[model samples]
Target: MMQYRFPENFWWGSASSGPQSEGATLRDGKSATIWDKWFDESPNRFFNQVGPQDTSTFYDHFRSDIQLMKQLNHNTFRTSIAWARLIPNGTGEVNPLAVRFYNDMLDELLANGIEPFINLFHFDMPLCMQEKGGWESREVVDAYADFAETCFRLFGGKVKFWFTFNEPIVPVEGGYLYDFHYPNVVDFRRAATVAYHTMLAHAKAVQRYRALQQEGQIGIVLNLTPSYPRSQHPSDLQASKIADLFFNRSFLDPAVKGEYPAELVELLKQYDQLPHCEAGDAELLAQGKVDLLGVNYYQPRRVKARANAVNPASPFMPEWFFDYYEMPGRKMNPHRGWEIYEKGIYDILINLRDNYGNIPSYISENGMGVEGEEKFLVEGQIQDDYRIKFVSDHLQWLHKGISENCACKGYHLWTFIDNWSWSNAYKNRYGFVQLDLATQKRTIKKSGEWFADVSRNNGF
Candidate 1:
């Protein structure tokens, strides 16, 4: 049998977001987030009319949940601090109750020997800030900076790992282009502006964190979909490279290297879609490079050159330059419909090693989401052998990368327990511990037990 030992002191944990897991949306002076407001306005947008108000009830069950972390042999865990919960209005006075809740939660996790990795934003923008244009307006950017500063000063002692945003592009895609998230608008220029301003906000947060001289490592979590060409043909290769530039490098470059890809800049300029930039914005980005990076890999993008040219009269979009090509014979996750390409993880780590100065990084989020997971329940425990295989395969590749001197540090699964996923709600379950929503109960699945062994033994 092959050994699967990981590096010493590797972080064994899971990743979660406040909006997706924490309930009590209205308790203790918590105000409305964009998700809360959107659900109220259009309940139909979310799956089964479920909203963000009542999730896994983590707000009330955090202590018990930390105990669950200990049961799973987790030494480190990642969860976001809902911006709306802390600064309900997106500015002005901080909520004392919110501060108390987070402090207590942090203390509980630390008390149980689980290192807490806290993220600042996870797409739950305060409703008041959205009314002021959210990421598009500079006013909201300043407000977010103030919010980051407050968090560092308030809870910087207990928390050692901080992330500015989680999958920032998802908002630009969902809200601005795809119309899945709130304030849905399909304007390419608006999407570009939102993307740019989000980077600015992240930079501002990093600047504030550094200014405080916080002991923790601050970073950003990005879902990087490596683009693969359908064939080695020049057109197809160019298409794939362009897709990578847009989806991956757009954020990766700025967050790590304190710069943007020039090719992307030229492409935007060619389309007359470059976002409006301000003085000192470049300086701010340069000064705010992260100390660590969290990579969330789930799928790969296969692209080919557009068969037909897009009409110049139509509004610009990222897909206007390339087309998605579904490769036949590609292995797929039958439950989630995502292509199963484990090599993408190794490729990303290698790219970071060769191009990004070998920055410290980790597998922030990777998992398989199975729909109707209750059917797998065997004697009241989910027999998630498929999840186990999925994780094991990915870990094999991650281990290879570490052997090659990649600065990869840890592996955090997509989540700790089955929690609410934005509009999808509970349609697709991706957790080692199965959650019984009806009883608010958490049960460790077969995969969870296996993972506990993996963590305890430092390998399989």
Candidate 2:
């Protein structure tokens, strides 16, 4: 007796990035991205020495992959254009072969009745730009805007939905605060600078897109991790507020409201960590607000007041303001080691409705990844019942939001296939189709078949 159904013309698909899914990292006049160079510098950093070049070969096999999308009843599919592949030097001459490949891919998707959602940057920066300080440099920001403009002019007519960046905060956290991602450094000031420039680049790109008068919607994808206080205690509440301000509002407010949060700005000034900004930057941001938003929700963040006072002599970081507190008896994703809180998705949508003017948005990524998923294989098909339940539970909440008139549009999974993750490689698979790395074979999982039915019925 399933009753919940998504809105008419609701989008159903999965998301992927060029570096993760496309294997031709260096072919067809493509230049090296940071991932390729990082792998070369430190092979031991990635899992089993797997590199960016080892992917699902989507660059060559996109025709068959689009067919698989039709079979799965996907009315939409999202993928990113590799900046290095499109413009080998990041801001100079364009690559004709890369242009042909992307044009063909977009055309094929449209030909099969699948809408193409294209993102400009997905953590894959060209090595030349990285050498010149990456996002930390305003020059790189300008270069990125040029790259984005090139994309809009080249593909905006065919691709109606455009995203400026995917999970913009991830790079800031990974490369600056943590040492997991490339250019790994432990400098909060540098992280702030990089984050500021990324938003600036997004704004500039939005400005460029508007100037072109392209008939499409442009937005940014943010992984909104709802911060929950441990209790109603004032200290815990304050901690959670600060975490939300630093992690979520830092980019959300600027991208949506075209301004940074006042509290966030004051905190940065207090810590003497405010990033350098040039003249007209604020105006650029204010003029370039997004037309749509893409939200990627996977888990909630639990936080509490700091247990100890910070030493004034130590370097300042966002962690100085609060502490992560793992709640006991919380549901957990065993394979990915992340807490599972399905209500977080609903909370995010409602927050947007009440606080952010109900900006049009969609669930850009929501999925569960399992380690060694092949264990569930039976008769050459994976019975991913857990993933099905996970998606259904989240969709039920999304339907609730839509019913309440939350401007939510669609739900796209984290991935279309088991593509290669940066450091984790293929350890945690989060795809409806199983990709056999050895054979390059694609087999639809049981969840894939069930998802197709849900899509065809527009409900479950």
Candidate 3:
């Protein structure tokens, strides 16, 4: 029954972040991040008033979690280092406790036969740094590079896989364009600035990693949403391309090719929305070319030509170029309300193969988040057969991509154990192992058991 077999040494695990899992935020010399400050200032902004402190407490229970990962047959996992936890001030002396914690955590993972993929930034900016305009300031960019260099010097011996930023555009979208995150600003120009500087910070991190001569791979995690036009009309096709240019190529080009797309630059220039760039930024971006890439695919974006003319007085935004088109009869995840386009995964891989040189890559984060998951629990366990099908269906396409010479090396689910999600809080659970918020209890769901077999067999 093993119809799809992955290549040898395929990465099989999940991804989580410190802000969503680690509970002891204020203790142990860790300074407040934007999450903490935002939650404190406006608790109602979070779902059910759940703050960052309400998590699965991975800080105290990582040992058991690692054991659970072993049981699930995970060969690798990805998590982020909280900047506020590592460097309390984001630029000053490194916290001794933070160093000890990371060292022990990495050593424990390695000892358990699990490879740790460390991501430097996961949208957790230190409060102090945010006061200095967060990613908008060149000073914060320099501080981020210093923080990255400190991490390389301290833990480079243990972690062989390092990522600069996880979905670098989320902060730009959430904080600047949308009102979902902290320091909410509804300005397209500010969002453009944030996106540019974040990539600049990433390039600076990559430059530092290479300069240190560390024996490892450095890359960035991009949540690539493939754009599909509703029709073959020229306007629809152009709309789709513009959406792709604004969302995907904005980060992907600079991260992989070390340069911005010419079309994108020209478009920005036409709109007068280009971010301020320094003299040597072009060279720095070229140096930031990644050795690997982590692709996080959740859903496909459907777009069509704008139905109505935009008001000339309205502020500039990516949406002015296109309108979201909902295709008829598209498959959907009933629980999460996201489209179930399994082929999107393969399309992304083939795009990388044909266009982006087939650089070494992997499915960094993919999973189905279901609300009210406990309703499906039976006999004291969650019978998440839906999740099992979701993974297998995606993997079949992934296997096909690999067979066709795509260089995707591994697959990591969105998470291992259900942890606190930002703003959504525990609204949607996307994990093989379900975590009980009240008692901090973790139980492997049916999908976890199924994944263990798939991982053991290298496929199914």
lDDT of each: 0.92, 0.93, 0.94
TM-score of each: 0.99, 0.99, 0.99
Off by over 4 Å in 2: none
lDDT of 1: 0.92
Comparing 2 and 3 on lDDT, the stronger one: 3
User: All candidates: CA RMSD in angstroms?
Assistant: 0.9, 0.9, 0.7
- Candidate 3 local lDDT, 411-437, one digit each (tens): 999989998998999999999999998
For lDDT, the strongest prediction is: 3
Alpha carbon lDDT at 170, candidate 3: 93
* Candidate 1 per-residue C-alpha lDDT over 1-460 given as tens digits, one digit per residue, 9 for 90 to 100: 4398888999999999999999998888888988988899999988898888769999999999889999999999999988888988889888999999999999999999999999999999999999999998999999999999999999999999999999999999999998999888999899999999999999999999998997889999999999999999999999999999889999999999998999999999998889999889999999779999999999889999999989888777888879999999999989889999998999999999999999999999999999998999999999999999999999999999999999999999988999999999988999988999889899999999999999999888
In model 3, how large is the Cα lDDT of residue 104?
90
Clashes of each: 0, 0, 0
Q: Which RMSD does model 1 reach against the true structure?
A: 0.9
lDDT of 3: 0.94
